[model samples]
Target: MTIQRLEVSNPEFTPNNTQMVTVHSSHLKRRHDINFYNVNASGQNLPVIILLHGVYGNSWVWMNLGGIDKAYEKVKAELNIPEFILAMPSDGGRLDGSAYLPSLNAGNYEKWIVEDVIDACKQTLDSVTHNSHFYISGLSMGGYGALRLGAKYPNLFNGISAHSAITKLADMAHFVETPLSEYQCEHSSEADVMYWLKKNHHQLPKIRFDCGQDDVLYESNLQFEKQLKDAQIPYLFEQFSGGHEWAYWHLHVQKTVKFFADIEQSL
Candidate 1:
């Protein structure tokens, strides 16, 4: 893993005010090196939250959005919290273009986040250890990525929240009557997303799903909520006045941080 200092700014943070570090995933055998953002406290050790972004974005989206501090300013202040870090890794996929599924080009993003990226962060960052837990969340494509990661790596993440995410790729394929483009090659089969759910279903983490009423993905998200309900999964769900845009996501990001902070204290 490689680390470098980055100049970042937003409504809530500036370069000096927040420690912005770039993370490079070094899987020696792999062809590509993934990039991600690490927003951390100035000193001491604290629990970390692995903040996954959507398909079309890199790790810098969180810092670009408002910095982690701005999103969770009120909650952190009100709770008198200990230091925490946000791990944002570029999932090595197209930005705002591809869905974060295992594609022919991007390889298996699930493994990249669950193993490779986490491993790199643990090695590169002193505060991050193998046992350090994470609270994960995302918006749109990111939301889908978060859900997939949390469900797949229950032991790694304590909880997860999604804002306007694509909950089910299989459902979307069925909805559109088309297989995922990347999974459409002659010998390639569609990703068994449901199989992933069933196999790891027993290890599911605390889940949360929310979306804008006017978002195009609203119906898809609603179907996912039903699957959770039918499966007796415990989660928090909310609907707000907006669409699948940055405005809603910016506010929703705060809610995610609060959720993480709350869960960390309980542990």
Candidate 2:
């Protein structure tokens, strides 16, 4: 993939040891932003966590709205978790969201995140490398992207976690005004999470997901959990007492950080 342009800020000037990067992606044929966080600037060969944002949000929402950076620090210090480089990229800037899917109308947002975003992190951060383990996580629509992409490309990611995800493409209607017809792909099953999960069940990595009990998508999440069990696929499912809001995500993101850290420690 071609990187037409790249810009990174000095860590000293940015908060939470964060560095912002703008990458000109060949897949999207447009420039997109990635917000990176490396607690120890000089640390090398650290694992990477790619966080995805939901509808009506961009890369900055992970830190600015959800306070993931703060949660990362708290989790690392409290749990003695290993250092991880956090990479949060935009969902290709479609209307309210791109759904992080490869669409006929919109650009190839799936490739933008699965391929370009990872390459941008390696090119911009000294701590990330080809050998670094990658984990994927997201909230809402992003949760759908994380689960689908992570399962579809098991070799690229070591673990997956999603929060209040839209279990099916049709569920997108609950949040976006974009026509669900636009998300249609060549294969009908391409938009289904269970399709990927079952297709790669033998080699799928550690998977976990959760939803606030009061969240609109809670029932769907429960149905997904049952599907996983029926298919005999391994996964972790949790239900928390909250709603589909930033407060719920912010409070629980630390669990995702810890979850990744635990996987790293096991490895």
Candidate 3:
């Protein structure tokens, strides 16, 4: 799949920021549209990091917090890190509280990510470099999406980070049974997530997860972390002071990029 570049605008943010563009294969076939902001480093061969956004959020949210561009800047500044490409996709329609799951409305979120979006990035972006690998990370629902997608397609991503992730979708369902502003969590099932894990846990990517100490989803994050620990899954788990807002996630993005950078170096 070739990247069909586009120039778009988000007046809410910086008007001058060019909407650097591309498309994934699955999207191209179905005419499914996803946006990406790509940053090329100084080196000829470099690893790539794909960033996924959270529920009710799009590619633009990461840019607003300066997280996406910051990741590029930090890694490039470190110099020890290889040149990298950051592709943040607006998982269309899946953001309506869908948690990147294959919705009745959205089809298979995981497939779109691993097969379509990623394949396109790799092929179109020249992913197979001489000295680099692929990586991914996300926040909240996107965090869940990152883990789930990485787990589903282990070879595609070298490492992953899940910040402020709603660890257990089944658990969230209970809370949504009543009502919550951001999510209709009832639509997703924990059993489904577990099924995904059961089928793909062996192929799971090296993962990192963290949540705000004061966030309501902290418990669920802890629960999933426990599951990973119990299964001897290799992962980094942490808790920091903050809440469910962008402030925590924005800060977490740096740590996430650093974590991936470290993993890339080791390999």
Question: How much lDDT does candidate 1 score?
Answer: 0.63
The residue-by-residue lDDT of candidate 1 on 1-267, one tens digit each, is 322322223525535434433333342224333333334455434567776665556767766764655666656777766556666767565434344455555455556667666665565566767667777777776677788767766777888888888776544443233345643422332343334455577887777779999988888877877877777667799888899777788777777877777787788
Candidate 3, 13-57: lDDT as tens digits:
623322333343343234344445543234545676777776667
* Candidates by TM-score, descending order: 2, 1, 3
User: In terms of TM-score, which candidate is strongest?
Assistant: 2
Runs of candidate 2 exceeding 4 Å displacement: none
After TM-score superposition, the amount by which residue 188's alpha carbon in candidate 3 deviates from its true location, in angstroms, is 10
Better of 2 and 3 by TM-score: 2
Per-residue error (Å), model 1, residue 35: 7.4
Higher-ranked by TM-score: 1 or 3 = 1
2 or 3, greater by lDDT:
2
lDDT of 2 at 198: 96
Error of 1 at 129 (Å): 1.9
Worst 10 residues of 1 by lDDT: 2-11
Instruction: Report the alpha-carbon TM-score of model 2 versus the true structure.
Output: 0.97
lDDT of 2: 0.89
Candidate 1 has what TM-score? 0.78
